[model samples]
Target: MSKNTQAPIPDSYPMTGGDGDYSYSRNSFYQRAGSEVAKSIVDNAIQENLDIKTISSSVSRNSFYIADFGCSVGPNTFTVVQNIIDAVQKKYQSDGLSSQVPEFEVFFNDHASNDFNTLFASLPPPRQYFAAGVPGSFHGRLFPESTLHIAYSSFSIQWLSKVPEELFDRNSMAWNKGRIYLTNAPNEVSEAYAAQFAKDMKNFLDARSKELVAGGLMVLTALSTPNEIYHFPVSPEFMFDLLGSSLMDMVKDGIISEEQVDEFNLPVFLASPEDMRRCIEKNGCFIIERMELLIPLSSINAQACAMNIRASVEGLISKHFGSEIIDELFGRFQKKLEESINLVEEIMTKRRNQLVTVLKRK
Candidate 1:
């Protein structure tokens, strides 16, 4: 086995309650917006033939192996697969190769901790595709060498591993007993996060290079920032601090253990275009095909956001605010959303464009 040295796993992950625990699937805001974004990526790849290679004679049609990395359960994956099929069919028709449909092998991969039972149960009727559990991180190789033709990962890979133990020293009072980095994390925190991202991205590419044949295409869509700020979305420090404060409040009130919070790592990071470009260059086998910035509309409204939050954070809320406070928490969050809708609209108008990139392996 290849030696792996990522961050430690968080306790809050591998969430309990199975499929029901992640009610985000049911939220229309998340589903619809995600589906639209995914469709655009697939369509762009096919039209551009991002992996086309020059031939001395006639161009040989290559077998297409498509994998949806970090594919979670439910309609999002299905919708993307359908769009890919449509794009392929359109390409074949345009090329005047109507005798047969191209052979495609589709794979759905997520963390082993994901609810495979729920995911597999909801899959579409089986055809010429295979489903396998990929337990390790996508930043590492999950398949054999040069076997992939196309790869896609959406809204995943943002979560970092739990903070490494080395970040804390025994004498640090800022340490919340492993609950979080000292309230005032050392200046190295920013560099540490960026370094991890660079390493993870490099691993992702190195693995992909080995798994993807020459002239393979990959379309990657993830959350990114516009400028080179230490924090993603122009407020990385603020967001982490806010979430840390929330988690710490729960710990102070005896809702969750300090160790538990320490173990829980948020799966979100904002990458700027420069960061993305640098990672691509480091990979050494991919060339940029297309890039765009977009902000998708939420599938759910304020009401549904409230519900998903309740389902996701209810346990934490109950621990801190007591079971009875659940309803109140939801109400307050929703009210805040409603009140800030105008401000959100204004801010988003300026930042609606997020980043999307299409890359081809050399």
Candidate 2:
């Protein structure tokens, strides 16, 4: 890979591991809820769009392969993969191929430092599918060519492979100074982030295209900022609004250096449906079969939402800002979040932009 597309560092630590209260497995209920909400849409997509007969017959008659990309140590990945397996079985039975139902193998993928031990230990027993853990950034290929029948990812892929290198160079126009996120960022900074997202997502699609057999299907569900919304301010990942402010507050108090603030930026990019469509079309390996948006986090309260963010980003934050400040930073975050509940309540009711897109490999 070129310098522009360099590999993500091995220690780009994933969600907090283990099954403890703060672990991603325990704190990621909102993502699991998203999987539940997306279940119907994914199942419908499989029944309506996945060329099951063609893929299974042409690819493998006795085994079906599925891969979950960007599968953190969280538990929701298990649910989403199971949903796909059940849906595929139903599709086969519906098409009078029940007798030929293939054995299922699922590949759970994530960053190399992800707690694969915990993920594997928590795997539900007597599962229908055989499970394997794959550790790597999903920006590039992990599996062999033309092997996967269905590729599923839920509430993932918003993460770029790494923070844009330009953001760290003071000489670069995109240097994000005094801010930790894209919200409230200048247009140039946001464009830099978007350019990196385009690169990461295109690499993702290209890799999946190579791994998926011809006529294979991919079901992807992710948090999206609709084209109409300037910044997706309502969701739990208001890392930009909530956590960034907390950091800046500390900066104002002289707890951390201004240069430290200038040097840091989250590697997440919340793309719109239009953005996803553009990237998919540009890759030219897959065609969108269905793209729709939904809102699913209304029931989660402020405190719960804060826990979700902490679980997802605590490792990354500690890596950059040291573990000593973690508690203080997130405490301010919770307080600010509770204080802003009214605005959040208003925005929650208005936006419906959790993007669920199903793609077919051409």
Candidate 3:
């Protein structure tokens, strides 16, 4: 296993809860689409590499633990886990171990503030596996040693444990005075963010390596920055800046202080494929089973697009800038979006890789 990481975990909040028009449950179309697009790759990975004999022999007996990290309140998480269960069941039957079919248990993990009530309430009426809510940072230890057999994460893990401490210091070049993220920032600001992402990914790998059993599998689909890109405003790199423009507009109108905008930055970083490979190899405990860039399957309109960003970042923004400004903030965002609505259609479609990867515990 890689050395234990001492990086601080993010004090992040959950996605906008409940099934409102702008709530995460209603607006996570891109995430849901990414899961659908990656399912076949995941199923094939499990079918070809699950090592059922070793799992049956060496892992916990008669029970398999699967975890979905960064799971927000959803029917999407439920459906994804069910798909995984079906694939695993198929593997067992193919290997003639149907007689010993293990009981499946799923752990839906997210931050402590995630809406467990909504998540549990939305659970499928007749789910095959037992369900549990696991609350904690995925970048740290959340499960018992050698407990999880398969770990799945879809369109999450972009968040840094926390925004880099350097970004907020006025004396530092990485202060990121006006922007909400490092995407279109100065060289030093971008470098500081990259350094923090490496730290968070190290901690994530360290924690998962310890949680997963021998021959365990981990499957993930993450929002990623492409190797070559010049356009694509909807992708995260430029997307938040669009909102930041509104925040600056509010600053001009004396609605909020520039300092408040300066202090607020999203704790997210889109990993490149090279970033994933470097972190996994340095961890030295897993085999890189698969790593490929794929596009999301679903599509939506420009208004759904603005709400999508609102749904994901609402909670975080509300916490920092006060809940009072939310309506005004997002209203301005929508107005700005309409002004230039001829941008990218699907989220991150033009230039994002949307990296999908599978790793096996060694």
Candidate 4:
């Protein structure tokens, strides 16, 4: 079925995985890094009875419905879904209703153009939930009203619905000429990105509020900047800066046109807690039960980090610049990153924070 809003997103490149020659499936250390955060959320939700008490006897032969929005290719997804289901079962056991445990239905959602075939093929066996794929953008309605009990998104909400149109208009004050994201950009450029994020986030909250049952739970983990800072020290924006610099290097080498760099921009934003809270409060359908920021403690090797970043964005770069230059570009990226190991290590130690929030349907 079609989503309520058919927005035009640059769908040419998804993260490198599944159908893409570069496998995010193989290089997804970032997803793995996020699994512990997701598991912790499920555990806390269970402790707080986030969705357990919401299960109504109104629906006969009740089944627990859980969804993972922006569920990329497998591996980490399997782990997270399993953790949630296990928590639910434990809750039932504690209530002495183990035998009456409801059937489970797990939905994996992402862009319609996502690699569903690869996602399904890699599903782990001895499944506790009846899994299904709901192909649509989460920024709009994807399910029937009040049908979902739990909705979870991990490291995914950072992506905006689309690049702001102002970024492309040469006459506009927000024209981001050399860079893709808002980092080091002018106030107008930052404002354009923020506006896009606000619009997309409002749509996201509104849609989810409609889909979730009363007292249903929504947990989201996303990249975030601190309250006082406009930019995250260890954000993908930094990587974009590096990529942008690398692209400029190629421009100097006469490898790619400068016009191409001028035309390209990523459709993603890292939100601040204040912005997130404001959006949630503005929606008025959900109450924030818990919010916390988590930073990865262990630092990954520079080369490994570069590969992980490549797996997540190589498709985007390759789509703009020909695939032929992929190796050269990333090779340059790795060397550039490696040379600054001390700085990268420092950033990784403090790292950007992941804003983990649990909201209860009002």
Candidate 5:
């Protein structure tokens, strides 16, 4: 389907992947860096009997379907699914429950526009496993009602569709050259983003609520910021600004046009814990069991963080700046990111990390 025709694919890129380009799935930086935090969440959910108990009680032996919403093509998916299986097996074993080993149907979902060929090719054999791709946004229904026992999404869901054009006036003015959606942009712009997030999240929870039997479980790990901050810039937009500055410098040097940079808008949105909690409560299905902040040491260092910043923006730079100038732009962009990181580090010691939440249906 065409990009315009498709509903917003949360956490998906505006463009398709090239041959052998599995950057979204293969970037071990996020998984390796975030594994410990992920493990703790799985361990806690098992220990506390968080949401699993609810689903386990309702479902027959070997009949439960466990879904990994937004499961990118990478080692993270395997790691998480294995962890869930181990947790469930241990639970059954300890209880002396002679129930047949649960048959797991793992649905690795993402946008239809995602690189499924790469994802499928990367997947290991499904010994005692059934795998399928559920394309489209998790915010919309992808599975039937009361079918899923567990759902998990990691390092995803923070992305929104491209910034809506109505956020700016029609006059085509450069209001905030270094800011996201104009530093002075109407609160409606921010609210528009916030409202979309709430709507999408509600759709996700509501759909899952219908699909999950009573007491089903959901674990979500995504990039979140403090609510009180009120105006913490979206990470992608920040990176975009960094890149835009570099592009503008090039334009001044007659390397590109102001129109080129003006045409771009990074697709990302970092929700806050409070925002998420409010949405969950509104859905009235899942109750938060545990929520923890996980900081990646690699991201904490200014230099390493800078590299990640570059990686995140690399695709957009290549698309907007053109292939010929991409390498030069990246070099300048990397230096600028390093400088930005240093400035940020001087005032802030560590990068705010992932927020891991485990919820049980109420």
Candidate 6:
């Protein structure tokens, strides 16, 4: 944990409730943003010529073990899980095993403090698969070794286990003052964030490698920035800049102190495809089956895009700064986003990219 963090960093943030304070459940913006990328991963996996017999041989039991890492309180997760289950069932039928109905054990995993009640209660009644909640960080082991057959995560791995600690030390050149995230920070700050992401990805892949049986599959979707473009008009990093500027505005207005901004750094990183490929190769535990950049986030309108960003970070912000300032802060954020969009109307038509990665356990 960073020494400057006002609150202890959880493995990930939680989104729950339909009230005005926690509107993630009611808002469909995030689901809309991630839907295409997730569907592509599932569809592409099904299209692959997977040997059902070989995959089934690795597991000892008749039941299939599936886990959704970082399954927040959102409806999109349900659709993604169903798609995976359907693909598995289709493979079984194609192998002339349609007579057998294998029990499906689905696990929803997130940080310890995630709102398990809301997530579980919202489960589809009379569900086809057995459901259970597994609370732990995906950066470490959460299940017994060789116990899982399939793992899926969408729009989640971008979050680091915690903010880079070097950013907290006053003497460190990586101290990310005047910015809450690594959006427009100096070269040193960006490098520090990349280092932390590499470490976390290593831990994530190592743990998943141990838990999943040989030949098991893992699919992940995450936000990424364009390498050629420093600051694209409609990128995730640009949305982050709007957020950082909002906090600075509060500081100027005496609504919040500048030290508060300096002390807080977001525990998130937008990894590029090259970064992921390098990490996977270094781990040597998983074979990269497919890697592609999915739908650009800029396809969504600026207002909806802003809402998607708000749904993701509101929980983390409210936790640090009290719930009192939530409405005012986002209200300012929405207006600023509109201004930014109008300024770059011509360039805004381009895509804001995301990465979809597929790996098989070796």
Alpha-carbon local distance difference test for all models = 0.59, 0.81, 0.82, 0.79, 0.64, 0.76
Note the clash tally of each candidate. 14, 0, 1, 0, 1, 0
Off by over 4 Å in 1: 1-8, 11-22, 51-63, 126-133, 161-187, 230-242, 248-267, 298-303, 306-350
RMSD of each: 5.7, 3.0, 4.4, 4.1, 4.6, 2.6
Instruction: Summing lDDT over every window of 10 consecutive residues in candidate 2, give the lowest-scoring window.
Output: 1-10
**How many backbone clashes can be found in candidate 6?**
0
Clashes in model 6: which pairs? none
Kindly list the per-residue Cα lDDT of model 2 for residues 25-67, writing each as its tens digit: 8898877877887889999998998887568655565878999
Estimate the TM-score for candidate 6: 0.91
What's the candidate order when arranged by decreasing lDDT? 3, 2, 4, 6, 5, 1
Candidate 4 per-residue lDDT, tens place, 221-303, comes to 88777663648446546766777788889889999887777777888888888889989998999989888877654776777
Error of 2 at 83 (Å): 1.1
Candidate 5 Cα lDDT to native: 0.64
**For model 2, what is the error of residue 87's alpha carbon versus the real structure, in angstroms, after optimal superposition?**
0.8
Q: Which model is ahead, 3 or 4, in terms of lDDT?
A: 3
What candidate 3 gets wrong by more than 4 Å, as runs, is: 1-10, 228-234
Q: Which candidate model has the greater TM-score, 3 or 6?
A: 3
TM-score versus the correct structure, for each prediction:
0.76, 0.94, 0.93, 0.93, 0.81, 0.91
Q: What is the lDDT of candidate 6?
A: 0.76
What does candidate 4 score on TM?
Answer: 0.93
TM-score of 5: 0.81
Residue lDDT tens for model 1, 54-159: 2101122645567888776655776777677678667666666655555666788876766667777877775455555566667778888777767877766554
Identify the candidate with maximal TM-score.
2
Q: Which candidate is the best by lDDT?
A: 3
